[model samples]
Target: MAKSNERRTNIFPLALVTLTGLFLVNLLGFIDTQTGSAFGCGRDWPLCNGKIIPEVWNTHVAIEFIHRLVVLADLLLLLFLIAATYRRYRGRKDIRILMGISFLAFSGEGVLGAISVLTDNPPSVLALHMGMSLIAFTSLYLWTATLRQIETGKYQRFDLQDASSVKQLRKWTWGTLIYSFLVVYFGAYVTFTGAGGYFQGWPFPTESYSQAKTALLIDLTHRLMALILFVLILRLFLFTFRLRGKREDLRAVSLQTLILVVFQMLSGALLIITKLNLIAFLLHVSIATFMVGSLGLLGLKASSLQEKERMKEYNL
Candidate 1:
């Protein structure tokens, strides 16, 4: 019984990590699509332009076709993880809840892909597709962490004081996460609107602000939110440093958050400087995803640590 339970407990975190890797690959596919590489394979869904292999070689075709392949792989991995989890934790409410979410998210991603192709690659649908993929990634991430705790015998319960602090942190962290999403959406808008190619220069349109208001607005909003996040993370680090009785886990999370935010900001600026080069753009997207994931992990760690501390106090 103990051995079986141990095997079940270990599966969730491993599955979650696999899911995150797949999510990263999918984001790469999105970047490829945005760069006009979606039909690189000549409009073939599972094959390269109706051939097992294409006789003609082109950058766009290679990118688009590879992206499709990656997505297919991701789907397979997710399904396998779900099946394994169900086998192990079929009756547990928490496992069932996460499995349901994972299933729904995978379905949504597939629908988005079909819609993108059917709509002749509509930008709105494509962008929303990427967003839904992120949701699926995040769900798996959370579930994986939960499983890790269970395996390590480190799962902690919350009390009133811990709950209050966590509530406050949750509010701030969630807000930051939402703001990050908006920044990513605006990036998609920049691509869809052809705004990146418009200015022909860095940080300014060729003409006055009034003529390029929409593009300018999108750029400005993303920049401003980035600034806000940087400051907010800086503040969080300071607060964590100053707080009495701060757990090691909380401090570690704060430090990691600060590092990720700085890297994200730098990557964004580099993308601008490179004039939206494909590699730069992908890096920007990847870093943004990383920031979101890190912040989420930090929030969870803080909450769990606080709960542990509270339990300790009560015991005393």
Candidate 2:
């Protein structure tokens, strides 16, 4: 308990800040990609034009250069947090496990990102970059919330007044988390395949449109995945809110999840309506990141119910 209190008081704020910084840097990366500055340095990575600072510079080069610098700083900060988590919370196996997972996912993202830069940003590589970012973001977000849970010892496990609701929350949240990852990957998949671009407008176009058979299939499948995700989340939200007993926390989670899904759908529309505008595209990715993170939070919270249930069986 003393250790938990010490960590809560000493380390949790830094964790939250680190999580936000990770999220922000990834957002910047997306903006850099959308703005077409990814090639600003002319395929020379780690150094722009073979100089620590480019002697000849333009807007694109400057953006890319600053982005690289920020990434270096972000990596350093994440490492510091990871080391601190190990030293300060080593006794807590759960926290250490989360730290390890976040570190590996983040490292994989960095590797993939570097590979893209060195390889002139291949379409297939770029398509998969955001998927790794999704994993890192979700892992770190869960770690942050878990740290707080450890500090305050607020499992809210005994608050599970309705066994049915907790069961539903756990089951549906697991499903949503898994399904959302596929949706994100397919979202990226459509971009590199040129499927989305070939199909103008979203949901239903103003008139009939035709495209290559493959492109049509990919684009339609992406939309179909989104529709299915929407239905699942909507059903979960209704279940979360309908619990007759005290499940306000789950209700709140449901509310946030529902809002993110709605905005994700809106951003998808904007991606088409704006003709794949850079900012709109960035918005689409940003919302998807947060929406996935929200469900990650739900999964973390849902675990507490299970843990408390086990405690009851132990007659503790």
Candidate 3:
């Protein structure tokens, strides 16, 4: 009975739900940014037109209202998660610290949303908002992953062979994740700034590069950066292959990371070929979101293993 009670105390399922909800809210915010009425609430934040709910309705208002409701839901759920997880996992510094970061990220996301409603929706502004969303998602993810690790009683890699390779892969994975963010952000910048929709070719080869708009140039740069990011992921994939015969978990992560990067690149190409198709855009962004999450998970796992190895050496 005591063991069951302890198991329930952690509230793993609740934490997972809360994190998933947070992701959905962030995704909704992106959707709203892409197709929303910035002035839907008429310069009135916390309340639309000083009312709990506006009497009139429009496409913009509806989308914006849904996003607001989701954010409110996230706020409520996050508070619950903070209180519950802290109580259950108080002994774990990692979980405690990540929960705090999760709270801060939730606050930042709210602030950015309110600001977006009050001001312009430029690509750069949206990129900042996206950055906050990414942080929130990542913190929650690590928090969740840590809890799962604690519950499973498997915190570090036990598999054989090269410790140095795992360490190097960790560095490479971290670098890839950061680089991916920059490339994706630049892509978003070009997107909201109206810089890349006109290029009709598959790989963005236009008739005259010299006579292109600034948006086209920016778009080209974004693509170039994305290609570089892909190569980095590929390098991580090769590193993982070295451990494929030994450690299944690390190798699996690297494999997924590589696969995601390939699909992301293909999706980006399809997005352009389809001439900025709405579905294609969402697909690209969705894949990028998950790709970041996967890469982040790999980094966390690798770092934990590295720390464990150092502690072992010290004890030895």
Candidate 4:
């Protein structure tokens, strides 16, 4: 009975639910954008068309309204997660820092979203919105992954990793994470500017790019960056996989990151083949979101392992 009670102390379930809820909210936000429902609420903040329930409703209004509702619910869940995590793991400074970043990112998402809606949805604002949503989702993901590791008593295995491997992995993981964020921002910009639809072919533009030269440039830049990101993730995965026997956690995250990047690239091609189908576009964005989260997770694990190595070296 005492052992069971002790096991129940971890908040893994709550953290998982909160993370899932936030991911759903981010997806819904993208759906709202793809459907041209940003102004469905008519420049209103927290109120749909000047009413709490939106008296008049259409498909656009419904999508935007539903997105707002989901965001509100996710906000509540994030607050609960923060409070619960603090109460249970207040001694862990790293977890507290993760929670703080999660809270700030969530708040930035809301603020940026509101500003975007009220300002007629500028392209830059919308792009920033995309990045902020990913930030919020990724931070929550790291928090949840950390809690699970602690609950399973697997975090101690970081000490098993050699200092050299930990140092190399840490550098690569952090570099990939930063580069991934840049790729996300560039992709988001392409989407917001409608540059993705300007292409006549996938992987290569078969038609003349004279008409939409600006879009062509934007889309081309994004594609180049995404390709580079894919290579980076692939390299990270291979290096981490080689050390799987020592750091399984890092290997797992790197593998997931590689898979998600592969799917994201495929979805981008599908999006072009389907003439930018809404579903394909959403899938592309969703995969990118998950890939970013996995990269963040890999970076977090690498950092933890490096810290463990340092502690061992210091004989503390």
CA lDDT, every model vs. true structure? 0.67, 0.77, 0.76, 0.83
lDDT of 3 at 301: 74
Candidate 3, 165: how far from true, in Å? Answer: 2.1
Clashing pairs in 2: none
lDDT leader: 4
Instruction: Flag regions of model 2 displaced more than 4 Å.
Output: 1-7, 152-165, 206-209, 304-316
TM-score ranking from best to worst? 4, 3, 2, 1
Candidate 4 TM-score over all chains jointly: 0.92
Candidate 3: the clashing residue pairs are none
- List model 2 lDDT by residue over 114-148, tens digit each: 78777867767887787888888888887788666
Q: Estimate each model's TM-score.
A: 0.80, 0.88, 0.90, 0.92
Query: Which 10 consecutive residues of model 3 have the lowest summed lDDT?
Result: 1-10
Q: Model 4 over residues 65-125: C-alpha lDDT tens digits?
A: 9999999998998898888888876766678788989999999999999998888788899
Name the better of 1 and 2 by TM-score.
2
Candidate 1 structure quality by residue, lDDT tens digits, 1-316: 1222445566866686677667666776667676777667765655677787787888887777677777777778877777877776565555566668767986797778766765687777777877777666766776676566555655434344555665676677767777666666666766666666445444333545787777777666666767888888787667666543645555677788798888887776677677777787777777766677777666666654434433443342
Identify the runs in model 4 with alpha carbons over 4 angstroms from their true place. 1-10, 156-161, 305-316
